[model samples]
Target chain A: MKFGVFYEISVPRPWDAEKEKTVYDNCLEQVRLADELGFDYVWAVEHHFLEEYSHCPAPEIFLTACAMQTNNIRVGHGIVVCVPEINHPVRIAERAAVLDLVSGGRLEFGTGRSATWTELGGFGADPDVTKETWDEIVRAVPKMWTQERYAHDGVCFQMPSRAVLPKPYQKPHPPMWVAVTSPGTDVDAAERGMGALGLTFGNMAEQEKKVANYHRIIQSCDPVGEFVNEQVATVNFLYCHEDQAQGIATGQRLAQTFGYMAAQLVSAREAYPSRSYASFGLLPQARRQATAPGEQPGVPEGLCIGDPERIIQALKGWESTGTTGVNFLLNVIETIPQEEVLASLRLFGEEVMPQFKEAPDANIRNARA
Target chain B: MPIYGTLALEEYAGAAPVTGELANEEWETDQAEALTLSYEIDDTYRLEMLPAALHPSIPLYAQIMVRSHGSSPVGAFNLAEVRLMTRAGSHYGGYTIGAFANTTESVEFLRTRYGWAVSLGDIALNQRHFGARAHVEVDGRCVLDMSIVHPQPITPGDFLVIAGFHLARVGSDLRLIQSEPSYEIEMIQRGKPRLTSIDTEAFGDVRVRPQNPIVATYLKGSFKLGRVRYLIDPTRPATEGTEQI
Candidate 1:
């Protein structure tokens, strides 16, 4: 079972410069600690122009910097907007190959068509063309890696005969993954032979059906990639500690902030132009008005809030989905203190992680026999 | 099986060049109009299309682009077509779109500079474009879209540069270009029978000069019959790249 931490650089409304710096500095520090603790992967999301919510616009650069500080943990592009407008296929191929080379094959290429209007519109990409653009780029990267001096005269881009050189360290290119917000995409990823990074944020019962459908399609897929890395992974809000009540108190507000902000960004496109990068599209009327006396924004579901024993019982449901890994979205909105984040990692690693860690000897011993 | 091929033209009969123009003077707006042009290839051409089920093992599309060689300078378009044909008494597949490609002299720009070379045994190339010397493949007969634009003031020699390969050929070539790689010209050809070379440039930086420069191609086999060529409307720009379902 692989373990990773998901980052959005989230900071809730009452923003300050120092708080922002601390969020990132703390995140980098958390990644360093995670590496020391034997975490498998460190993932970062690539979001653009969503001020206050996500400042990780230049994720490739951040991942490159992360590559230096960590030795064991794999660096990941949790999701690089794969549409041609946001990043040309050639550009994506070049960046991914360079990172794979730098990381010594410890890179996983996760791709997606943007869900928010701000990013998609900023690049002048047509929503109608998003899926096709995603499919073409995803299918094209492996070719660009293997082909010598490749040129493509497709609907999106045309290049003259020039070798796209410096192939990746991973054979047949780096591992391929696609972010799926909906269950339909899970099956699409399986059919295309890409790992499913399900960010649906739902219960174990929902995930079970999603994973079962994905496995069925994967069994018959003629992958566009070099190899079939049939794996499914998911992310959930996490704040674990020795005392269950304290863990909940520390995680609740920040988790709610991350959840609420993500939904607002996606839903805003319906009311205004998604491509209008200047505006976040959050109209005054849409803002959550002050409820009657003491109420606040609704609490989000699927959040893991408890001690090791309770968290373990909640996570057992994840195994039912047959997922290979689960990324913990910690430190959302910076509600938890830096020390608390580190302690949670320690407690979770000592008690919770041991149960899920895949024995290194299992695969080797099976192969040798 | 060979998936697609192009028709030989005794006289190059085709459409106008591509010009980047907006639907309106909507300044700074993201909306832009895209057009596509298409052509059909005959049975004599050698190329094959594998079934979709055999994807990574066999790439689904072989993309090509076309540039202006006359007074009219049409922009680039991608070609992907699927067709059924009979090759040596067997059914094969084809995919073609409207686009332009570089002549033999044009592709050499990639290899001579960066020592870039494609392992053609793995991908498919048109015998009409690469000639008999290059390792072009074909298992069955199929149709393809190779968009070749003829700019205005039609002259004897003019063409666009075409590059890129199917999955079998993407490797160090992709990496080098991404990391500031260069290319050189190795071969040049005029028409279908004669071939030659000009000069080389960085693989990523091949340009079409003076609007209409004469281009060349090398044919793999001799043809006794005639093939179809397309002539598109000058006002209509070619929209021939990838299309979302």
Candidate 2:
């Protein structure tokens, strides 16, 4: 499986002027190191009003910075909220095209409707209509990227026929993906011929079921973009050390800190009853993962936290599930010191990554061919 | 570390009266009907209302639930409550702002046992042809009037009701007691929420204004309010302060 670095950019409270700046600087430094380490992608999330949990409201700007600082790593604007109140489709298409152009056509476009009331309510966007709006935006954005002039009168937006400028450097546009959190969303991604960006932290058995269903359904998919971007990438936390015990103890801090912050946010399904938000998006799983030290018997199954050998064993299980890639979150609220984080990255690159290097992009190349 | 609540411990202690003793026995109720209306509230006072042990929910919201119990330990009664969504450490739940019950027996029993900030009030929950309506009056003045509109049938599992945290003086210390109840839902329906009137100050805060109606649900079920399993110190982070009963 391919490897990638994912960032939530968590900033702890009592913020001094330098806190946010320092966090961003550390992230860019990590991104630069990952590029040299042969990491395949750098992914950043778009979250607003989630203080301490995520300070990254503008991922496009962060990805642009990553693209500027790195040479080989692909830039993934993993998800731009498809709500019009937050972003107009024309603007999303335009910004993505520029990022692709600047990055030499290394972009993976991920899309989703915002899941938290903290964000959707902050923007006065109706949760009931977000699904419909996302559907409209995803279908339209590709047309904007491919068609010389795109126009539409839809439920969420309306525009006169006009040329959408700066068509992407890639022949057909960058790969498109859907953020899959709720159950059955993998099928939604598969039906639309988009990549399934798995966001929930589930066990190997659960992931195996989702990946099998996704590969099965996509055989008859109708492409939402110019081509079928068939891939599955899941998220996990990483902290590798020479000593297995020390690595797990430290990684527990990173995981617990993130889970604690996540529990404080009100998901759309929790605050509002909507058929649209079928499950409590990602909060419950995150909270469960954030167990206090010694609360759990051992590292939960499938977590990439331990010595390099242990992480390799866990990842082989993920590979057996047919997922194309795994994205690792490095830290939360600076819980792990910078030097250790960098060392972990280097260790992972040197010892763990080489084990699964063969045919990393075989699926993508096949889809394109 | 998580963000700690900013509301002073003394202020939280003074918000409600001290209870008698922690109730050890679980209480069960017969067939019940409930109407729940939830709305997003202004988050400006998010930190000012909860004690140091809890974390305010992002984009703070509140739930107003009115229920009619067919039979209970205190006999049949109607109860109405207002709760601010919050988190105790990594657990998601609600912090009681205010509560009211139609019968004085329920008000006394719940307040002394579970630490609910309950007082006597006039409350009614009625099922209509279009949907369900709930209203509460304190001293003959309307405090809450809300309804569910265009009801559509839904599965019993689709609706989730979180637990509650009540601040009461347990012994000499102010504690946030957890009251988690399990429900066996027989029928449930989801619908658009409509609020005709609400006196926010009556629920103890003017900042609890409802900006947007999220959703309304009406269900028929039976519930068991279990014995208190945990207590938290109001002056520290829940991770460090929570204790098992």
Candidate 3:
């Protein structure tokens, strides 16, 4: 499977004055390394007010930095919070087009509504209207790129029809995607005719079932834009080393830390409990419980968190399951020294990626040049 | 190409300090023991149940009853606290809206000591393996008879956070006090609070008539006060209260 690096830009607590710098610098360096090592994309997440779990609030800024430093690697907004409160639709349309122009058309516009009350309430967004707001912004952004003037009478945006320029360098618009963490969101993404960036697929069997369903549904989905991006890019942890023991050890440590940090950010019910939180936990309870407590927190069975040979074998199952690409989250928790993370990327490039380079169907990607 | 380079990203210089236990496996904190059952009421209810003194952006009322086992100033207490979701231009935590405590000790300790608007009441907090029930009566009038069943177990990844907020008082001048305590809690469950009854006349304009209560369970907790940040000191003049934020 095709692989790319992902960043939540996780910084552990007990912050120093230089914490932001250390995290951003390491992240930019990773993007540059990924570009040189023949990686596909450097996907960045947009999250707000989540202490340590995600220090990245402004992903466009980070992705711009990624584009400036990398030549070959595609810079992705794995999501821009698709609500007017976090970001306005017009501004999102403008900034995305600008990034596309700057990055030489290497942009994958993934969108999503903010999940936590800390984020939604912080931005004063109505939790009830978040999904509809996401739908409007995601649909309208493409029209902003192709049309001379864009306007909507909807309450979310009351723009007087005006030229929404300068258009993206890509002919129609960049490929659109949605961050799918909920169980049926793969189907939802397909229905909306967007790429399914599955954030919480637990196992190969589940992924196989979901991916098959996603493809089947997308064939008949009414497109939200001119073109539909039918692809499944599943999120997974990646650590490769000559020694299998070392790889799994480092991988599981960071994986567990990531899970713990993610859990802490899962909206505190005592703070802002609501009925809208039914689908908050993406991975099923039964699936998560199967990993046994002592093993790493989110290391589901048969993931790409091992040595070159092990990772290669594991990916074979994923590819057979109809997976298009794997978003390899390369860093977290600040425990893995920056240099060691760099080394992990280099090793994956050298040993694992080459095995799939010659595969007949790598990915029929939206990387339209 | 260089148009966006001129802009600076939003950054927080510092944050309210909390234990990093939930984030890292190596991170550890002293566990506190308390039993709490809370309910989520409507925001309009905050206009009455929550003190207007807090000037909360949004109000959350919980029919919280507690059995302080460790580090909690001894004894059992129930508080129908209307908490502000945010205040003073930051989300440090929720503040005491309006509170009622069963024991005289808890009422005075929380009110006179911490500036909470705690009053005396008759209350019960019953917690079982499967579910919990909380009942309250203020001024010899039954106020709350709520129960929450079929608790959904909370996984460690989604941990319970400390309830942090400012306590406002209007006696002898307007006083706003940020309480000095950090809570360390373990084990939590989520369920809906079934409200049997609520009378707003007894609690002032608080019309908290909800069919479904956002019920929650938190247990095994301790609290220790860290450095307290004072926006308004009771000893200070009234002018100081509004200027602090």
CA lDDT, every prediction? 0.50, 0.85, 0.64
Residues B176-199, candidate 3, lDDT per residue (tens digit)?
Answer: 555544455555565655556656
What local lDDT does model 1 show for residue A50?
A: 68
Q: What is the TM-score ranking, best to worst?
A: 2, 3, 1
Q: Model 1: per-residue lDDT, tens digit, B1-245?
A: 11212222211122111111111111111111111121111212222222121111111112122121211012221112121211110101111212222333322322322222311111223323333221112222222222223311212122111121111112211111100101121232323112111111111102211111122232111111111111111111111121111
Per-residue lDDT tens digits for candidate 3, residues A139-222, read 788888989988788868878898987899887888889988655778889997888887764688888999999999987787
lDDT of 1 by residue, A235-338 (tens): 87678878888877766765555544543342223212223122222221112331211122344444566898877776776865687778888876666788
Using DockQ as the measure, name the better of candidate 1 and candidate 3: 3
Candidate 2 residue lDDT tens string, A1-369: 888999889998878879999999999999999999999999998999988889998998999999999999999977889999999999999999999999999898999998898898789898878988998999999999999999999999999999998999887889999988877779989988899987767788989999999999988887788788879999989999999999988988777677777777888878766778887676546645543311221234688998999999999999999988999999999999999999999999999999987584545432334
Query: Which stretch of 10 consecutive residues in model 2 chain A shows the poorest summed lDDT?
Result: A290-299
TM-score of 2: 0.94
Model 3: lDDT of residue A24: 89
**Candidate 1: residue A215 lDDT (0-100):** 83
Ranking, DockQ, top scorer first: 2, 3, 1
- Candidate 3, superposed: residue stretches over 4 Å from native: A268-276, A281-287, A290-298, A358-369, B1-245
Best by TM-score: 2
TM-score of 1: 0.55
Q: Report the C-alpha lDDT of model 2 over B24-99, residue by residue, as the tens digit.
A: 9888786899999888777777888788888777767888899888988899999988898888777778888888
